[model samples]
Target: MIRSVVFDIGETLTSDTRYWADWARWLAIPTHTMSALVGAVVAQGRDNADAIRLIKPGCDVAAEWHARRTAGQDEYLDETDLYPDVRPALQRLRDAGLWVGVAGNQNHRVGDLLRGMKLPADAIGTSSEWGLAKPDRRFFDRVAEWAPGERHEIVYVGDHPANDITPGRAAGLRTAHLRRGPLGHLWADSPAVAAADWRAISLHDLADQLTSRPGGAVPAPSM
Candidate 1:
């Protein structure tokens, strides 16, 4: 029985098209160039941020983020950036008597933006706010802390298996591989992703499945 559902931010609840495009603009490169670089890095199992470094070696991506913010072009997300199913999916989960939370590998500013949207969330958290980021055991531990029931009763949903499904399982929570984003689509059929408790094409699919299985302990995907 799933008692809570915690969602990842980028590519899960919202898209990252604007983010990489902004970086391309700031670096004076074509958006397609940056997009290709991001795909290349991900294909090599490297961090997506490596695309930025691939453009300008030894570049401090963090510093660049600060620079963008100082220029009044900081990271942000509004309704337009969110997926069409996000609002209704979250609301559906909440209506099913499950706790719904939003947390991800994002900074506090992004967290603030999510909260400001007044989405149907019980709580919203971010990596910067938690002082931890995903793929780290401690980060999933922090995410698990938001649940109202046992770890197994909490389903951690995200697009990336390494940061989400893998670490989420290690943290003793159920894992849901949300297949939509770059990493999500590219690795959707991988063995790692196949190990998640659930694989969802959309939040609506997830909400329907989980809610229907309440108190029944829907089994995890076969290895």
Candidate 2:
């Protein structure tokens, strides 16, 4: 049986894209313009830090953007919200005897985001704190350490193809892709799988897959 369910924080459990898009607009940069810049960086296969560097003005703008988003820290903690069905799904996983945890590449503020959402502290993990991010085998190794037992018993859910699905699959865990936007092209080469909102699939689907016999777990070939 699936003993644990690991999740990626951004996009998978929370929606921060709107906040970033709105921040860009407030800074007088068009949303699509910023998107194009990001697209170019991705197309070049730049790392996250490199991509962030290419977007000039750096953390100052990021801080300002976040500050505005949270209304100058007055409402900073209040700005974060869980995906619509996230809480219920997590509860279900926990109730079903599956260990639920989070693993993501996030800044220091990630802790704050989790606190704001009231997610249990014991279930969370982040790359910034872990010193490694997704797609890196180390991240999965750490997760394996946290949960213990069989690697095949874990199911990882994430939004990015490279960061989440590819590495999770490589690490021997079942993988679930949370389709949000234009990621289809990235996974175009992969076999097809079902899609669901936070409420639709719930953690039960994940639990069912991971607990299945070897090779019974659905293949999530990288796109």
Candidate 3:
């Protein structure tokens, strides 16, 4: 039985428009241009961060972030960024006696913001806090360590194919590939999502699927 459920942050639980818009403002580029570059890179199977480099070659992203913090231009997430479905979905899962958490390829500042929001998650962390990022098997290894119980008992849900579904499965956990957000829609019909334990349109759908399974528990996977 699946005893735990962990979630991805950006585009999974939260809309990332504010994030990209802030970066565009910082770079003095039009938001539409930033969006276009982001879509281009994602469609090409490249890291979305490459869009920043495309706008300003030789720019060090980490250094730029530090500079922004020093200049008091730091941006952070809050309830406003969260999807309307996020709270009730998490509540439903937790109410069903599943352990819930939020983890993803976010920075420490984002980690702080999530903590402040005080969502239903029992645990929350980010790439910067764990010093690990997804699409790396080692990062999923860390997730396994952070979550409770055996690997098979935990299901990771996210909208990213490579970062969330692929790595979470490689780490021996179940995966739910959510068909929301840019990456989600782009890869919705692809083979990458085909292997997921569940394909969901929203967190509510995932919650219902998980909660309504046989015996009111997520069915055990075949060995």
User: Which lDDT tens digits does candidate 3 get at residues 72-162?
Assistant: 8897787889999999999999999988989999888899999999999999999999989998998888878888878888888999998
> Considering every candidate listed, which one attains the maximal lDDT?
1
Query: What TM-score does candidate 3 get on C-alpha atoms?
Result: 0.93
Q: Distance (Å) between predicted and true CA of 11, model 3?
A: 0.6
Q: Write one digit per residue (lDDT tens) for candidate 2, span 1-223.
A: 5677788876677765664465456556777766666666655656533434555555565565467657653222234446666676677667666678887887656756675566642467678888987779989888888874588777677767777777777777766776543342444334433321111133344444444432344543333
Per-model lDDT: 0.88, 0.61, 0.87
Tens-place lDDT per residue, model 1, 14-82, is 999989998999999999999999999998999989999999999998998889889999987888999
Best by TM-score: 1
What residue pairs are clashing in model 1? Answer: none
- Order by TM-score, highest first: 1, 3, 2
In model 1, how large is the Cα lDDT of residue 160? 93
Clashing pairs in 2: 187-223
